[model samples]
Target: MKPVIRLATAFSILATGCAFGAEQHVVCPARLEPDAVQPNRPPSGWQLHMLRPVYLTEGGMLHGPPAESAFLVPDGGTSRKVGKQSGETQHWSFDVPHGYTKWMYCGYGGGGATLKLFRQVAEGATECTLSSQSADGVIKEVVEFVCK
Candidate 1:
């Protein structure tokens, strides 16, 4: 079946519950536009990148070791760097796809500081929020961008 159909089916199943007498689980893999993919980056075409990697502890991430660099991608597919320590602010340009209504996020605890997001405008460009802190610190800001 086409990916969109498959995704819809999965959600339908999840929302209404199994049709049969037994419990069923539907897993739908994300579909990507092959031509839009870039090497060393994640697949695109997803409308929502939910619970996307935001922070990791000193051990790297929730699942493994320290990253060469820490970052999170929200707003459909725009990447924002999660710095190595708490309270660090890096400027991010809102290159998010149009039509997304709001961006939401929260950080992991490690640097004894909370992760914060900020917005600003510079030279007519929309400057999105930055992920603060942790060179050796690990955090994952659970972020979401919802469409209007």
Candidate 2:
């Protein structure tokens, strides 16, 4: 059963105190190499030197996890991995480094984090989606806007 909290109560609580890192969940999705055999966590590839992390509004069934989290969590946290595909439209990609093939992807929400992906399509080709959900069921679509 869903816990019931009065609107007034919520307002009172939020108004009373605001916690740091509460909105720091929305994060860049991870990516793995095409031939990678490992699962869980970001493949050794998903790397961003300047993520410029920001927080956006997260929408969910009210039962969703916090924004910047994950959509379908396995153990905890958000990550990704993938296999080689014929087409290049896949939302996932990677950069090979350290002699090991590492995959890479730019997503608005948590993408390519699943051991096996269901949807690998993104909105933009070169640009990462500005709005995406997390594995924890958190919605961080409005992160950029919120930060702005």
Candidate 3:
């Protein structure tokens, strides 16, 4: 009888575990737009990173900077540079861990800038674009994320 009782308990526990695993999780957004004022955050189990080949636009011309400094600033966390310089563009790699409220992009050596925030909504990686403008010694940084 004791052995039977033990087996029953084990089965019950297994059933409960399965039920928990089957529960539906929150879905991520399809795409996120750029927001100069506010930061953006991703859903659980999703990772955030700055995509490579950062581009710069000036006077209606688009080009990559020889050496630019970019950072990933998380809310209430230390900021980190994207990556080392490589050729024309920066190496560009920084991951924002899940569950940190929100994050924003900050870049140096720009006149003025704007920011665009995007939230990822899929399992795979999303390619986002950040555009900034220089004005009045103010640098605005913008980031956009496109969901796959």
Candidate 4:
């Protein structure tokens, strides 16, 4: 009787675990194509601009050792540096051509920090701003822009 009871309890626990696992699911966005062009100038009518800030913090305070460099890469293009600024933040702009709609802005930093921006702006929208942040490393903030 004792052996039978032990087996029954073990079986019930295993069944419950399996049922919970079966209900768990994860959803992810579709992959994008590799970047092909890194044009030196914007296409014709539109433009994309980006800003990145790098910093270090300690004990909830905004001061520490200088952070490693950060980079921004637009979809269908190569990585570009955010030019230096007076303080911790850096800024740069990219040229987007007329009729170009979709964009994926990626930010990378030393020490494995990363951030991403996935956005779709309206056709007549004159200006739009999108931003993202990473939890760790040099990339603290990423701000993107699309303007007519």
Residue 40 of model 3 has an lDDT of 38
Clashes of 3: 20
Query: Can you write out model 1's per-residue Cα lDDT over 25-101, one digit (the tens) per residue?
Result: 22111222332222333346444222332232221111111122233343332233434444433333444445332
In candidate 3, residue 11 scores what lDDT?
A: 13
lDDT of 4 by residue, 1-148 (tens): 0001111211111111113223111111112122211224555685533333323221000111113122333223222344432112222233446744422233223343232222223333333223233343233443333222
Worst 10 residues of 4 by lDDT: 57-66
lDDT tens digits by residue: candidate 2, 1-148: 1112122211111111114413212222233233223223443676323233322223111112222233321111233423321111112122212333211212222343222222221112211222343333434222221110
**Global lDDT of each model?**
0.27, 0.24, 0.24, 0.26
TM-score of each: 0.22, 0.17, 0.19, 0.22
Off by over 4 Å in 2: 1-22, 34-148
Minimal lDDT window, size 10, model 3: 1-10
Rate residue 3 of model 1 by lDDT: 17
**TM-score of candidate 4 versus the correct structure, residues matched by position:** 0.22
Pick by TM-score: 2 or 4, better one: 4
For model 2, what is the alpha-carbon lDDT of residue 34?
31
Model 1 regions lying over 4 Å from their true place: 1-87, 109-125, 131-148
